[model samples]
Target: MSDAPREIEALIEMMAKLPGLGPRSARRAVLHLIKKRGLLMNPLAEAMQAVAQTARECLNCGNISTGDVCPICTSEKRANGELCVVEDVADLWAMERSNVFKGRYHVLGGTLSALDAVGPDELRIPKLIDRVTSEGITEVILALNATIDGQTTAHYIADQLDGRVNVTSLAQGVPIGGELDYLDDGTITAALRARKSL
Candidate 1:
């Protein structure tokens, strides 16, 4: 009875599976996009297609990039002898939003989990150590989440880099098991500024 097609409904269903969207919101979004197809939807679809085709992880620091090495990893200016380690790319982006740290980042992809059989090798730990040596890193900051897994990963990294470079972790008030992505930018800056050594 309706003009809307089944293909359009399928797109909405797929969009609803995304993190925050539900069926109601997805339906509304799809309708809105269809209404503004010429102005918004076409460009959005092209951009998504481009990213989907080109996105790849940086071989060095594990940051997402279209190129072999991410911009940060290749930038001479960003080679400030400081390395910020994060559990996820989202966490790295949150730290970048704060603009507090002037160094490159090493994304771990995920934390070490004994329960899930995740180990140091599964993460970018070995690569991080290599960067410390080759990049002449003076400080290694752990901006991991405050969860048990995050802390455990932090300690493991600290131990790995012990006596090699200054190892520090984001200070108190991170909220137990709080994620960097969920924190306000100001809170992230404060936590980074007040970070203490391991």
Candidate 2:
């Protein structure tokens, strides 16, 4: 039996289920939190509770927001006639971290996955098309991952918006310091296809 109290062990088990954390890591984390209960644990618990109560998906863009519409969708400065489509809120957040794109976003929730029985109707694809029409979006940038499912979703979205708006995708490429020898054939081919003049 676990030496930890029932509640603490339960917390550790739940934490272990989180991405990137295993049982050992979760145990360490729980110990650290217990040690810093007054400073870290209480505040974290309160914050998580607050977010759990208020966090909701944006009605317009499918982004996680405390309000019905996320701040990005409501911001006047972000209405730049461009929409970046991503497979999930995590991907959207990654793009936001770059701070390069000055447009709004459409979180698809997930890519169309035949294996998992995911379809366009299951995602926010219909809402994306509606947004393109209603928001006067002139360009749709597909910033999906390079996985097969991601590519399939991108192609499907492009076809759906064929004549409506300019559809583009993030360039597939070799990383800044990547060695060609270490790359896969698909990466090399994609890089060659996306080659540009110096």
Candidate 3:
């Protein structure tokens, strides 16, 4: 049992549930918060509370938002003919960080998983199809991860929108600075298949 009080122990346990945080790390974080209660803990708590109260899914694209629509969905400048489809909000945020894709986004929330019984209805796939027609999207870019389930989901989406719109996918191969010797068999195969002529 921990020597800390019940409240502090509870806090540590709660923090331990966060991604990438173990019990020991949570304990250290809790202790740090206690040490900087006035300067850090109060603001952190306030911010968490604000987010908890205001956070909601965007009605249009399934992105997280405080209002019915996310800023990206509402912005007129993002209304290009291209629509990028991602597996989650984190993927959408990553794309935004790159600043390469100027068009709007559609978050599918997760990939299809037959083992887990997740299907098209479980994701935002239907909404994606509706948006393709309603928003006058000319191109649908599948930005899913290069996993089995991600590939399955991408294929399903492509088949669904086969004749309706042009479909494309993010290229999968080697990283920018990655060494060929360090890459695995799959990476080498994919890179060889996607090889470009100089």
Give every collision pair in model 3: none
Candidate rank order under TM-score: 3, 2, 1
Steric clash pairs (candidate 2): none
Candidate 2 yields a Cα-based lDDT of 0.96
- Backbone clashes counted, model 3: 0
Better of 2 and 3 by TM-score: 3
- Model 1 TM: 0.83
Residue range with the least summed lDDT across 10 consecutive positions in model 3: 1-10
For model 2, the superposed segments whose C-alpha errors exceed 4 Å read none
* TM match of model 3 to true structure: 0.98
lDDT of 1 by residue, 1-198 (tens): 655698998999999999999999999999999999999999999999999999999999888889989988888999999899999889888998988888999999899999999999999999999989999999999999978899899999999899999998877557678998898887788778878899
Encode model 3's per-residue lDDT on 18-105: one tens digit a residue.
9999999999999999999999999999999999999999999999999999999999999999999999999999999999999999
Better of 1 and 2 by TM-score: 2
RMSD of each: 5.9, 1.2, 0.9
The list of candidate 3 runs beyond 4 A from truth reads: none
